[model samples]
Target: MRFPHVRRGKAEEPPGIVGVARVDLRTKVLVRRLEPGDIAVIDHADLDRVSADELIACRVAAVVNAAKSVTGRYPNLGPRLLLEAGIPLIDDVGAEVLSRIADGATVRLDKDVLYNARDQVLAKGVLMTEETLDAAMEDANAGVPTQIDSFAANTLEFLRRERDMLTHGIDVPRLTTRMLDKHVLVVVRGYRYREDLRALRPYIREYRPVLLAVDAGADALLEAGYRPHVIIGDMDSVSDEALQVGAELVVHAYPDGRAPGMGRLRGLGLDGVSLPAPGTSEDVALLVADACGASLIAVVGTHWTLEEFLDKGRPGMASTFLTHLRVGSKLVNARGVHQLYQSRISGWALAALMIAAAVTIGVAIAYSPTGPILGNWISATWHTFAYWFTGLFK
Candidate 1:
């Protein structure tokens, strides 16, 4: 049920937002290639906050979603985040939108309709605004109990299935990189990771903790000019350059021993250790560090709240819940570590203070009763020194 603008041989195109369309069913994959001012076409339902944050960072002109942005599913915060950022969001456009609008094709979006370069309508959807998103969020909040029930069921099922591993310990792989009694920084490419990592720079420089990166988190570390000591995850999002950085690779796999990352490592002629576990890569990373005798584990970009766990949209989140229970004694958020331990004063601060003191003293002396006399003497001393130095050079 799309409305087409059928004005033929128009002198000027319709007034609307114009940009190249980047279409993908997976929002995460699409965001990587999207440039600022491009229109993002995604099929994400109940769009999570993490995905919305990425889309916002890309500075997209508009978002056209093939699926409903919100389905009263646990009050997801993605649509609201987009609206707050002033990015136009068109919701519930049919899946046909993906096929109708070609990727990398120039398109124009009016209030609710998307038009191709020829000014023909491709798809139409409900435009999401602050008012509509707020109404949806309220209704969605009513559905949280159902989601919580589902979450509880999944958590119970996971606990039943993974009780032994959770109680005893994961069969961690051996590594050349040591963690015994050392502070371990487990970096995940999750919520506000960049800001938290930037804040932790002083702590990172001072402590020099073992950097454990999960998939794309390795790239984040490298971007911040730090080499990861260990990289662990399914081989999907991490780059080839990160793989070749000589970090000890640990391929986390299914408990049944299906290691997808191992094949990728082999293809690159690289060796890796495999640790098959029940939970997420982050969970496995934390547990592995604890088992290896880490003094403390500081995590960056980890999901901590119920909304965050729901945003993750995975049954494996139940395993992460259990993982938290197991590692609660020593586990701490990176922001928490940055807040608790005050970094020592730097030499730069000292130098700046010294310079300020010198300037204040000179100003006070220059305004004193002997100001003119001191100024003349200083000028004469400088002139004499310069002449003496020049004579020696001659």
Candidate 2:
């Protein structure tokens, strides 16, 4: 409630179904107790990290959400868990609200509907509404697929910018020799990118791209079966293990000539190159790859949405924009390049699944009073055959 956010009142904006409330931000409620019918806005993506277990344990009449749940880019049955426990599930108030409201903002519901806190109410309208609930369900259904496409497109744009930034031409920074024989994997600290990388690890080892970690991405790369070729950042999130991994270090210095990572590298007895680039760790990593003439820079676990940056509580979006613009042409996301990279299930895996299904069906049918065991077995076996036949990848 002590946090500052713009305030608007219900009188300022009408209370009916003015618009869809989609909650994507999930954060801890600083208030004492959420009343039975009071509508609350949750907006942090890592609710598990940001929210207290007690807040989640609260049984409310209804709840509105704002962030993607842990179950991928979609809203899982998490909010519904409370609802099924007797609380009603309401809308997912999307990024639009975060762009509008702030911490400790007071809002009015109806006659007895004044929801107040020490914080300024950033929301101008009523929280719980039938229209808002419907919108949350609709968004929950659509959020996952939309997120996947957005991730893919942002990755593509990042690669292209990287290629361009490399050729930007700086003659003063000749402290290192540049070569392009190896491929590059540009890493960023994105949510579940490590899992995504784990799912696709085999392919990464296959390509054997020069692993370039952008701060926290160094740990991610190591976890996903790759040694980093270079660690690039301001020495903030890159771990101690990642620091001395024998990878060449590049300290991204401020334009003011302060190289933060240099001191860390020096203490570790590691040599590092400094690049005076003004942007994010990811951006600096891309620039290093370009300057070194790294061929084919691929990206993983990168931030793709504006809301993502806001979740980090950053004051600006300049670094993200600049990084994308710099590495737009040459980046490809982790596709089915893992063993499953774009490959459909083989007849063997499908046949295995079908057989697994048929055995259970036969067991169930044998116990059915109306079932002809012989006929049921035959039908199930046929389905298994047909499924395998259709599922076979040519």
Candidate 3:
């Protein structure tokens, strides 16, 4: 359904507006007028930071992007899933687009296109989709639309077939390490997963997962008040403090048998072992947990697509090549910890609330503040508190 464009300054929304869904940013920034109920659609500076799978699982119906997603500048998963799910999308809604939108402004997608399950363009024009992306790129690359679609369809089909074979109860060759049976928490380096991690604190603390870091993830996990049992990967992104934190370090080596990260491990006075497989640090991590017989492996900020791989600008993914081989059914992408676990007020929150309430009540009785402005501010604060509390249930 097309949302009627709300001309700036209009308080009344036309029927076209289905309600504002929050915009997330990545390549560009959009600051639109919005209200509390609006979706916080966003794009991160790093595409991998945006969790498309979780977003879909939560079932947002529309998105406005501030980046050139289907423009060949980045991966297609974000736009691809939106289109497939029939979510309306507008691309390149950068800073300019944001400035025009106000909090609670009904966001209208004047141009949204869609594609069907068969990869056929059901609708086209203003919205972003792989078809639009392919056509624009194909035109420049001198390839026909049909040919590109054929290749992509075949590729998607093959991926599905392979996933079925690999994940559907079969055993294959895998890397071995003994930490597999531990409650493993895999960390990815310097991403926007901080909020996700913070929200996951209850689970992490309650379960006490074996904290495993892949380079920078070691530093991140440490900062979050967690200790690393093992730090895996190239050892480049990890901090010296983290290296010194007493976690065992293992260097990942290339297939040619060169362990480049070994030197870094040595410099940190840590002994290392080489896992010469092909993939990202995350890929080898899965192998490590699986090989080690991890009872359950949970991944935070893990990459799941070619777009993410390409966005990293790596040549190939050899380490990840056999990862599905090792941890086929043992993996869990714990992106939405907020959804998986309920936050109980517990005795702590309740006790803290009582103390705060007593202070607020005592101050109000003593001061008897009378200014309308101050009263309004207090009301807004309460309203905002109520909004966030509702999100916990949502």
Best-performing candidate as measured by lDDT: 1
| Per-residue lDDT of candidate 1, residues 221-267 (tens digit) | 99888999999999788888999999999999988899999999999
TM-score of each: 0.85, 0.46, 0.48
* Model 1, residue pairs in steric clash: none
- Candidate 2's C-alpha runs over 4 A off are 1-181, 335-394
Ranking by TM-score: 1, 3, 2
| Residue range with the least summed lDDT across 10 consecutive positions in model 1 | 1-10
Rank by lDDT (best first): 1, 3, 2
lDDT of 3 by residue, 305-388 (tens): 544544453433422434554575777767777666766778898999999998997677657756556668788999999999
- Cα deviation of 290, candidate 3, in Å: 0.4
Return the number of clashes found in candidate 3: 40
lDDT of 1 at 357: 100
Q: Scored by CA lDDT, what does every candidate get?
A: 0.89, 0.56, 0.58
TM-score preference between candidates 1 and 3, better one: 1
How many backbone clashes does every candidate have? 0, 44, 40
> How far is each candidate from the true structure, as Cα RMSD in Å?
5.0, 15.9, 17.0
